[model samples]
Target: MNTASWGSAGRFGLARYVMAAALARTADGGAVVAIVLLVTTQGGSGSLAGFLAACITAPHLLGPFVARRIDLADDGRKVIAFACVLYSFALAAAVLSYGHTPAILTGLLLSISGCCGPLLTGGISSRLPTIVGSDQHSQRRAQGWDVATYGIGGTIGPSVVAAVSSWASPGLAAFCLAVAAFCAAWLVMRLPYSAPEHGGDVQNVPSAWSTIALMVKDGPLRRTLYMTMLVAFSMAALPITAVHMTTLIGSPAASAAAMTAAYGIGNLTGSIGVMLRPLRGSPDHLMSVLALCVIAGLFAVMVSPTLLIAIATFWLAGIVNAFFFAATLAARTEYAPAKGRGQVFLWVAAMKITAGSAGTAAAGAMTGWDVRIPLIVGIGLIGCAVALSFVERSMERF
Candidate 1:
């Protein structure tokens, strides 16, 4: 292909692939929300809700190992496509069993579906650089697109599930999820194979722990991973805050849904802003600003007497989230060798999942106390993250 034709074809391909990835995320998020709501309607408790959340997130902790396996495999595309099919099956099964069994079984199925999340994310992310060729600018733009897809998927997915479940049944939501996964698998199959530049022999593949150990020894990657974990922890406080608002407003379901929607809006806006102006500063500086925005936004949400004010703050926080996400991904990609990209991203996902689960659990435990406690803790965590940015800066100089 000529240069112009190749660039055009590549851009079109990337768009198609990204849209498919976004749809998969949308299905995943939508299915979780639908399942939770379905269980609640069938008399599940708040504690059960917490358990369901944990199940969905627990798979992230296993992502590192999955990514390592993908890296060692000769056909990443086939692995990703198969995972997508498995994910579709899991969601379909969960929907089928929604009200037929105990809440625990439903949670288990959802957890299994959640395990595919990191694979989808890592697989798509690793493909982007190759699709965009060597144009650093376009690659950055692609990252922005990825963030936008995530935010948009998150926002629309729940709305679709809620609507579908309401109009038909929760099982319908699973059908939607199946469609998404199928689309993703199809798109991935269409892409030309691009092997990792820093290829490694399958016989000499490193264990997950050893891969993580290597990542931690790299100064920039370690700092970026730490920041990602802190961000995840801070974001975890959103659900806690939503719970508090629901209690205070005397409309728990309605309030939770609204707040979640608002947070998604913030994320979407942030992603768009990053696309408009990709970061020019060091990763530490860029993330510090985003952290500060999150801290301020959290404080605003905590004290807001009206839901409108809370929504506004959350929207701003979402913008910060988008910027930080793009910066972090770029930094991580830069720090890791090409061969290790999948493993690095997986490690980042693992840390975020573990920290987020802990944060959520801690928030749940504090339910008897002031509902705002988690928000306060969230602020503190963001501050600590900001402080860590400075530490990263200092380490960079060495």
Candidate 2:
């Protein structure tokens, strides 16, 4: 048997995908921070802030429907590029509320723009195999690379939003981040766009319900989704808790910046780790480790009495978060059937979006509650997910 080299898999497509994914993720991370701060800081009601967050996040529930276009398109790149352009404009429009625009109007604009998120995220994720190569090793590496870009974006977006909004204003910060969508569109346009693979029968395609039903009925797919679902719940609460972290350390002007930066720096470290040594184990083992990372980080955060200790805990969490994404991608590579794989990717990404929104909403509803509540909840949920873990080798396999 012959082994394939990473050099042989082609770098141009991978580079393009990474660029596009990073910009999209950065825009997303910045937008989340911008909207929350833009609202709450400006004396807007907590309800309104949560509403805006939901406006941006809820549309992703339409992912399966919206992403079908990508799954069926002749060229997913064109579809993605076109979507990115629209998303950019819509997000820019939403930033208008920072100028004292009406919340209703801003929410409407945000909802309109956010519908494109799944395309940028899941739609792009589904394109990985085509962009990099169809081989398992290539696809797995592609997934790790994708996670790396997302981690970078997630790391940088918040600090940029925090610093810019604090120094300048939320409107400027949001508008600036909106530029990422334009960048993503251009990079996507330059992708080594490949047609759908040869020899698959389009007519034999599974009905959306049937495909979803199959995924629902399948153990590994079901479990994978469950794990991400739990993770998302915890992740959603971070923005609010981040604000609290800032308040705790007596730096209202730099609220959450330290913790968010710690997470971002840690995420970058994890991405580099993936580049150097991509996960070399089965999906379950990776998931277990990822769970442990989250659990440990949250535990450390829970016990920390000072800002410095909290930063280190947040950093640990960020590192594991990167590995969690890589591990999830590995799970998809291992379990998702070629048939309806696009749907699976979109579904996975969409779940994260939706779950995060729900968690944020939950945190928002507890406005007067202790800051530690959400973090504790996140830890417990992840702990439960770990308990559900299943391994491989027929000993842990199908």
Candidate 3:
């Protein structure tokens, strides 16, 4: 039952899980771009497109509940696959309903898809401990690959939509996302069954609220989640700041796009680096080191005189950030109680989403005043996270 071995079958199972996760995340990532493009091209107003995007994104806050359901399900795999199927169907429905049916109807369908979004992200991550068993080395390696999937999806998702929408039609492009989700659903089913639950009786698993309390009580886990949210706040502000940088430096709008792509490439590079040379010693220690690196990178970005320089700094920041992410994942696996692992992962992810949204809004408001303002704020957030990491280390002394 321990699928942790690096044998052929184990490798294949891991590959399937990675590929499926990539596809599911790609669909989730591209849905917003596809929706915006489709609506705009079809004469729908930008506000309407924004409304639809909001509908799809706002419900992502419901991810912890979805994770709870999966944790409690008789067959977790089936529940995950079901969520993917619903995500696929809802995407297709939204695509078809746009302009043909009422806008509200389309929004409703997208909202349904959004509600299922967590399974594609944190939900999948929550399964990693079980997939690789309790070996810290195996979990670390698997997490490297897992982190790469996010980079793959984040980079390719919008590119796929842009290329397809340009060549064929937005409708086709949007439908393609739905198809990707469906394929992911099939792949989810192909994953190996759970390797016999080990923590306790599934029937006696604590309720979501109780699980949440457990997560909060674990100091390491709590610190990990808090630091992650702080880092996310900084990340969410970058795009808007990048765009504003373009304006100040007289760089083309595409430069901002390039900066985004660079970040994705950096993320991929970092993930691969970790896979080749998995972190040793404590993940918490590495987190502190990586957090310092990110802070340095952000400082370079803040001081960049040229748009190109800014893009390069962002890429470097992304690489360190990915390593930081792996450390957090390792922390989560090591510290979270097995019975509540799913809730811990999903809820932490949800908190990141909430924090990122707030960061984005704050950045959007501040850009009119000055672009440096947001970067300064991001730097401050990282500083705060690093400070918290020190506090945690101090707590361990006692």
Candidate 4:
């Protein structure tokens, strides 16, 4: 494609994809928050809330295999479109089925929505390089846009749910989420059919599990995967911080929402950084710095128990996290074999899922031992990640 053609495709594709991503994120965040709140209101314990949280991360464990399958397909465009539609319908069904009597069915529907989550995210990651432009700079910029969209959507979605839940009802919040999902599906439907350039027949395609095994055997890919998992585990501190601030410090829901908003702002800012200047140093070096910054931010959280201070610290942590995550993703994408891009991204998603599930479960279990226990553990893990970065640097040089 010519420069003009590439630019036009990127503009059009980004516009539509961002809409879809934002809606998808809004649905995902709003549904999780709303479900937890509803369950609690219905006299359920924190265990139920934790289970719902786990539901959100559980599908990630399967994302790698899913990505492999999607990647092997000749028609990724169709797969993405179908997934979007199915996801939308599922969210809508969950919204419509909300009530006290059919609680079990409602939970099942919510879990189903979670299962569709990775398919959309992974599909987009794989599709963007094809549709936007193949150049590394252009591809990075496109991913930056994606990151910003998630931040904006994530920041807004939870606040919307919180507002609706407090003023109206959880059902209303869920309904809004359903509408967002439908909008995402509509936006996705407009894109041109773009698939991986490495065309091959289905009969020759490798199994998803085999692809994952091959990726794992690659040293840089494995290191990157570990880094992603650590970063994700560290982020578990975010929700835990919110819960702590509300339960222990007597902070209002607005405070939690503001903290989240600040975190989103940090992510947006980091995306801008990625667009403006390339991290000229090695990925390991940059990631090491980011890891230390993350630890510093977590420590800040530990010391500052008040609402405003906590919010500021969380926002700073978010900025650091944005840099860390964006850099890691860019590196992973750069290192991935062209044919294995989808599987690589899928592995990243799976790591995130595994880390998030572990972190949340641990956090929920240790909620009694000081609400900030998870944050401490997060800080320690980032420390380990920092150490691992040095090892990665040496490996790279060799």
Candidate 5:
């Protein structure tokens, strides 16, 4: 009711949710970096590094199950709060496993922690409406704030990992990530808690599988999901390309930091642009912009002769990435049915996160071929996605 409440959090936000989400996203951003560092520190090979990363992300595939439960339950916050605690403990175990345990055991602990990713990202996302109410304008602003905070977290997370790992150790970075999750848990506890049956009538609640089926049956939502998956796939090239380019340029690894900074700055800038002037158009229009950004960004990386050019291009791509996601979140908020919103939110999160992970891993394999080859493939996929969006428009006219 009062704009002041949201205003205090900065940019029309819920302070508590924004704080918790920022912490969660930071952990999400850092955990992979920490995992790689830990594996390498432990004298493990690249395969093990990839495997541990998978352990952390693979659980996203099952995120929908918890999201479904959250939707059907009275209060989703309880599920999220519990997940927060679980991640803290599980990640701690992962930290312990780094020395005494084998990679498999460490990975097992990471997998346990990974289950919390979806709940933290998508599950918490579903709570936005509860905090901000359903008014379109207010909700979009809140979502934009969310996007900005998420970018801020992404920017901070890796920096934290790199700094901590360099000065102290990779193990310490993992511990810091756990502390972030613990802090997130504490923050969630401060939020208004509700019982599990907020919606009432268990019999009326549909299963997650059925909801997913219904969602896919919709033409626009399905198309949007498919299109975004392509963007996610392309976006993977950013990290892989950054790592490779650093090696190629023989520049200090810190050069990669500049690239990341550019991306983060771009994301914050783009999110504000969306919040300032919300676009009005079909989802196809939004997806087209997203795809174009991916195409241009990747192409820039492929052709960049110097590290400076790559940084500039990455900055532009980051702007497009942030804009694409902010606009898409608002669109998803608008399209999702009231009853099934939680499931849909998590489903989208799961799909995009998984696709991004797969893209990164796949890209890693191709670095041996040529640094630019993976990004080239990423650009082509994004272009195809853009083409598909136009096809949908043409079909609608027919």
Candidate 6:
């Protein structure tokens, strides 16, 4: 928070953190796509591709446990750096073992990498408060940039995979992810060390279950986490639903790409909006409003008669969703105790990922019946979020 601390070195430290976090995120986001492509190219079935991807993601369930270790570490950055290095090596090993070694071996390697995935997401985010200090303005500014990395990774990660796969081999493309993660590790090592407040001593850290109970017992945090899961449930289905909608509307399948692209652009725009003019009012209220707007946008997309209308609506929904994401981050920062902040972030993120995976699977199963069904399902999920928001608000009156 001190401008004196934020000298040239501090500015560069922030830059390094951004770059490292972004690269790590790109690797995390692209790993599944690369695995799918690599496995399929190696004469494996779609089922194998899916299995490998699941193998990589299943370890994310350990996020809470991972965060406990991070919170207890004397220097959390060292833990993150180590995780990045381990992740990079595991990915590289998986690529090498795909064809030459046993299939189960490769899965094990990927699962090892997946165990470290939380450090790239929630783990990195937990450190932001420490890095920027307790200054509200600085925290908001840094949070905007930190949130932007997710959008950037979402947009660029797959693109990088596609480009690399086309130019070289799928194995090479997968290996590139390893390289990116390694670069992130190198960058992480350069960051100024800042330990979590009241988080250094082993005895000071509470149990992960305590954090979970806190999330449930705290009104705003509970509402925020629940809403996050609800939104993720719907948002995760978008890709499958978008492709299905293209089929139903008699549009080219490539139109799905346009719709997703629009959504990505909208997300980036919203991140920039956060940086330029951060949202006003309580993060809890802002979350509710932004979620409602997302619901409206999704409803518009569902009723759209043409592909262009759907694309535009998707973009609008994306913008609102980005703001919703920022609100959630703010809520966590405001409500979570310093001792368990890492666990709070990681557990919340783990829940989101798990919910998203379930939603994706549900959409895949239901889309064959009718495209509208998935969109309806998505809208219904957001409706639950809105209802939860109102319920939380009303409970405060009592």
Give each model's whole-structure lDDT.
Answer: 0.75, 0.76, 0.82, 0.71, 0.79, 0.84
lDDT tens string, model 1, 282-387? 6656767777877887787788777777777777777777888888877766676666677887788668768877777788877568888888877887788678
Deviation (Å) of 207 in candidate 4: 2.6
User: How do the candidates rank by lDDT, highest first?
Assistant: 6, 3, 5, 2, 1, 4
Q: In candidate 3, which residue ranges exceed 4 Å CA deviation?
A: 1-5, 195-200
lDDT of 4: 0.71
lDDT of 4 by residue, 1-398 (tens): 33457866667877787777777777766667877776677677798677765665576566666666666667676666666666667766765665543656756666666777776665566666666666667767766776776676667788898999999877678778877776777777676566554587555454676666766676666667777788788787677667666756678866777776677787788877776764555564666777788888778867876788878877787878777776676766678776667777767776776787677778777767887788888878878877876776687779
At residue 70, candidate 1 shows an lDDT of 66
Candidate 5 per-residue C-alpha lDDT over 253-366 given as tens digits, one digit per residue, 9 for 90 to 100 = 879878867877888888887778765566457768767876887787778778888788888888888878876686567777677778888888899998887888788898
- Candidate 1 backbone collisions, by pair: 266-318, 267-318, 270-319
How does each model score on TM-score?
Answer: 0.87, 0.84, 0.94, 0.86, 0.88, 0.96
Candidate 2, pairs of clashing residues: 391-396, 392-396
Least accurate 10 contiguous residues by lDDT in model 5: 4-13
Pairs in steric clash, model 3: none
Model 5's TM-score against the true structure = 0.88
Q: Which ten residues in a row have the lowest lDDT in candidate 1?
A: 1-10
RMSD of 4: 3.2
Model 6 C-alpha lDDT versus the unseen true structure: 0.84
Could you tell me which residue pairs clash in candidate 4?
none
lDDT of 5: 0.79
| Candidate 3, lDDT over the whole model | 0.82
Better of 1 and 6 by TM-score: 6
